[model samples]
Target chain A: MQNLRIPGPTPCPEEVLKAMGQQMINHRGPEMAAIMKEVAEKLKYFFQTKNDVLVLTGSGTGGLEAAAVNFLSPGDTVLSVSIGVFGERFAKIASIFGAKIIALNFEQGKAADPALVKKALTEHPEIKAVLVTHNETSTGITNDLKPLASVIKGAGKLLLVDAISSLSSINLPVDEWGCDVVVSGSQKGWMVPPGLAFISVSPEAWKANAESKMPRFYWDLAKHKASIEKGQTPWTPCVSVIVALHTALIMMEKEGMQNIFKRHQKIADFTRKGVKELGLTLLAEEKYASNTVTAIVATEGLDVKKLLKIMREEYNTVLAGGQGPLEGKIFRIGHLGWVTENDIKVTLDNLKLALPKAGFRS
Target chain B: MQNLRIPGPTPCPEEVLKAMGQQMINHRGPEMAAIMKEVAEKLKYFFQTKNDVLVLTGSGTGGLEAAAVNFLSPGDTVLSVSIGVFGERFAKIASIFGAKIIALNFEQGKAADPALVKKALTEHPEIKAVLVTHNETSTGITNDLKPLASVIKGAGKLLLVDAISSLSSINLPVDEWGCDVVVSGSQKGWMVPPGLAFISVSPEAWKANAESKMPRFYWDLAKHKASIEKGQTPWTPCVSVIVALHTALIMMEKEGMQNIFKRHQKIADFTRKGVKELGLTLLAEEKYASNTVTAIVATEGLDVKKLLKIMREEYNTVLAGGQGPLEGKIFRIGHLGWVTENDIKVTLDNLKLALPKAGFRS
Candidate 1:
């Protein structure tokens, strides 16, 4: 296997992978109930919330859709705070679902400014909700969500957060932050493969659900909540991934969330320092850099495609290229889940060697 | 492991299970592209469709929702044909999405009559589409889809099918049957775990999609189609499941569809016959019995719950109980995907022994 360094779909542990290979079981039976009950409880530690963290079988985008449709209806005004591609994606999902969007976009590599978000809300007093991404994986910027959450919650509007790539690595306590809905996926810091997405809904979000009138059935959060309470899922779940998640959660519980967060922070700091030492420029604003993934801007005359190709083909190291407008202008290295500092050392070492070959000059 | 006999989530082959344990790879990279291309091509063989087969990362219900949302707008009249629980589910999904449903109901253990469907469409000329369930796992009754497709398509209406429990196990040639859209799940006859759903769309469905005005984003078929053509999915797909599916599909190709269908047929026949000899009555009408799952009626004075428990606890044999109104009134034996005559024999032997212990005099 190549040294995979994408933001999500991070490498899983051997125990988790082996757990995924177990035989299929009756999803509605006692066996499934035990797994669901245990997994749901343990997820509270990762989410750091007392709210109901219902699991759905899909990618992170599905969880974002669930968050949007369950809280706001057509023509309802929503302030979408965008820092990068994923932040913009949450806004696009809301717009597609009929929410009138007031987009508050920051610069590509900077986090959302809480004051600007407050100004947008004041300008559009009709805004019923605010969408925020805790981490923008595309540009490797981690939004300072506490102050943003405080501003949105102070305005008494629903706060839905896309914590897809940040929840397990970053320290965002859902209840402490007063986030009404937080959406995440299994492929990120959860140390599992992609299949399941999780959503933690506050009591305030449930209140929104009662009156929200966007057309949805499969992505219904209320149905997932009810079924999860019964130790069941409304639809047939991805049993193998859930099994894997259970194992991953157990491992997480053993390591503790605080330690996991510290490990990510340490590795990310090491990566950023190493990249600078190698004469590379970081894409993200220094203070707001993400702990899960680090983005490096391609200098002029440097072949970003050739750089990625060389890393992947010659060294068997894979990294993510920028999405949308940032495509071919930046590349990302993921340090989430099971990554270690030594892994970062090897990656940066490889980059130092490959940089010259890809036409990068000091 | 215990004998897992559910309609869907049938046991995978050892190779497929091991494949599910593979490490994560970049979903947008060439490795994933290769997997997607091969899986998409081989899926056409199973779907028996010349149309574009798109892969979506969700369960069968998500696929059904995709099928409905893509082809019809709000208040557009749709003829929803129902024989059992899953049939009703498809209509519920369409109804939730704001389609005006003209439900054509058939008796619970019976197949949908083509004549009745034709009559409903004739009476409801405003109906733009007809929803059919090729196999109803809840009642172990497979609809006679070819004739029903003929009647619905003859009227120039789109025919959307829920083949969740049938598909590869029983044959429904998408092109020949004129199925405008066919939805299936990975947990069924695919011999893989749940988490992915396959949808095949014909030219007629795409035309309908152009005019269809339903609020959707994550379940968007157009986005999925565009991305799939480039050997990618609209969302970060369930990588491990897709890897396992590749292995499962390879096994299927080697076995061939004809032989697979025949195997399901033979095992189903053995299960039905074995149940009859054990003095349990089948719930399905004789001619419409499903090859995937076999539902047996709970005889009077028999403790159905106790019977299932005895079978599970003593024999390590798991089976499905009925759903909705049929709950506790029937028990089902699944014979789809990786099942054999000997497996059926073992399950039957357990049931025969457990039936008496649960107060079934015979």
Candidate 2:
């Protein structure tokens, strides 16, 4: 069997996969309502917020669009604190919906500076909301959201977070951070398939939604809120994935949040240490390194493509290559969701042999 | 096991369900590219169009939103032909996106009138598009799309179709009917789970897309078309559902379109005749009755909820309640997507007994 590892489409546990094969149920019936109620209640525990978390039947990008159009109107001034590709995507979505974005960009593999964000908000007093990514999967960097949230919320700006790749694996504490809206996907730390996106809406975000003028229907949070109150989704949801998510959540609850975090922390540490022992440079600084995925700088004269190929074909292991400008310059190892130290050990052992084969010698 | 007989979230074959449990593959890798190419080619056979059919990762309603937001600009005049709840929902989505709508509605449980649609287009000379549903699952009626398409296409108006429930089971030759845009769901006749929506876009629709001014990003078909050309979705799709769909499509191709249509026709006939023999009345007229779902009017003096309860609790058969105004007045029995004559017979047999227990002697 292949050790399938990517950032978001992480491998699911056998039980979670089996749960996805359960027969379809009536989405509007009492049974479905019961599932909805259970999933909704359990979701709050991960979000760490008392806000109503509504489930949408699309990918994480769809959830980001919902975060944008539901709270910010055309010509609304917004500050986007982008650290990597996903952070930039959040801003791009807002811009596409006509939000006048003031982009505050950090380096490719660095976290957003809260001081710069504060300065941007101070300079642009007209900014209505601040968009940030809790984890930048593209560069394997997690932002320091507590300080950033304090800066944005202190300015009374609505804080929208793209927690797609970070939520369940990392501790976000949405309520404590005063995030107005937080978006996440199921395929990441939930150990579920990629069909559902969860969004938590605070009261301030709902106030923004009422006056927001961007045209929307499918991603409208108000409709979801009204429907979810009665234990239903406004649209027909991805039923099987939701069922699988229920199983994953129950397992997660059993394991407890602190254990889940410690597990990811340990695996991420092992991966980083293994790469360093191989004499490779890490992409992100250790302070901002993400606990879900690890990125390593491609060694000089090493064909990253060949290394990845050898890993996939010869080792039965799959890893992610850098995206966009970082392509061929770095490779990513995903250690999130259902991953263990043994999986990381096998990958590192195979990589040790494959590196030299790909012209990397130390 | 519960018999899920809703119009959507239809029951899948065991193999298809097993396919959904396959381990995750890299969505951007060569393996996923192969699945995308195969599923894309097979989907054209179902859509019956040379147009590029893009698979989205949301429910059918999201597909409808894509069809409208991609082709129609805000302030654009559009004629919406409504026969049921879903038809009205199409218009509602358009209106929500700021399209000026001229509604031409038919009676409940009836199909759209081609003459009225033509008249409406004539009256509204500025009408840029005509939105209609091929099969109204809410009322169990299938509109005569050929005539409606002829009217709209003859007038040089863009023809957008919601074929969510009738695409594979009932014939909808998109290209032959000159359909500009067609939307469908996987949960219906595709015999897959409820996470994917497929849309076929014609060249003329692409032309309209260039000028569509409604602000959109996630549901933008242009982005989908660009990414699908590279054998990738613009977003992380519901990967498991796509895997399931590949299996479902292969089975469909083996059965052949003619055989699939005939199978649905036989079961629908059996269901209608059985319902009538049980001294019940079908909601839809014979000429426009859908071949997927059969709607029966709740007999007077009998509690429709009680009948549904008896069917569910005693026979383990779950039926669909009516939507909007039809709620409590009609119950729907879905016969699409892996359903058999035996399944319908069992539902009918149970209904015969359920009616008397719910206080209906006849």
Per DockQ, the best of the predicted structures is 1
Tens digits of lDDT, candidate 1, A1-362: 67898898898889999999999999998999999999999998789999999999999999999999888999999999999888889999999889999989998999999999989888889999999999999999999999999999999999999999999999999999899999999999999999999999999899999999998899888888889988999999999999999999989989989999999999999999999998889999999999999999999567889999999999889988989999999999999998999888989989988989999995
Q: Give DockQ per model, in order.
A: 0.89, 0.87
Q: Which stretches of candidate 2 lie over 4 Å from their true place?
A: none
lDDT tens digits, residue span B171-257, model 1: 999999999899999999999999999999999899999999987788899999999988899899999999999999999999999
Q: How good is chain A of candidate 1, measured by TM-score? A: 0.99
- Give residue A171's lDDT in candidate 2 (0 to 100): 91
Q: Which CAPRI category fits model 1?
A: high
Where does candidate 1 stray beyond 4 Å?
none
- Measured with C-alpha atoms, the lDDT of residue A202 in candidate 2 is 98
lDDT string for model 2 (A1-362, tens) is 78876787999999999999988998988888999999999999989989999999999999999999999999999999998888888999899888999999998999988989988998999999999999999999999999999999999999999999999999999999899999999999999989899999999989999999987899999999999988899999999999999999999999999999999999999989998998999999899999998988887677889988999999999999998889999999988888999999999999989998887876
Q: What is the DockQ of the complex in model 1?
A: 0.89
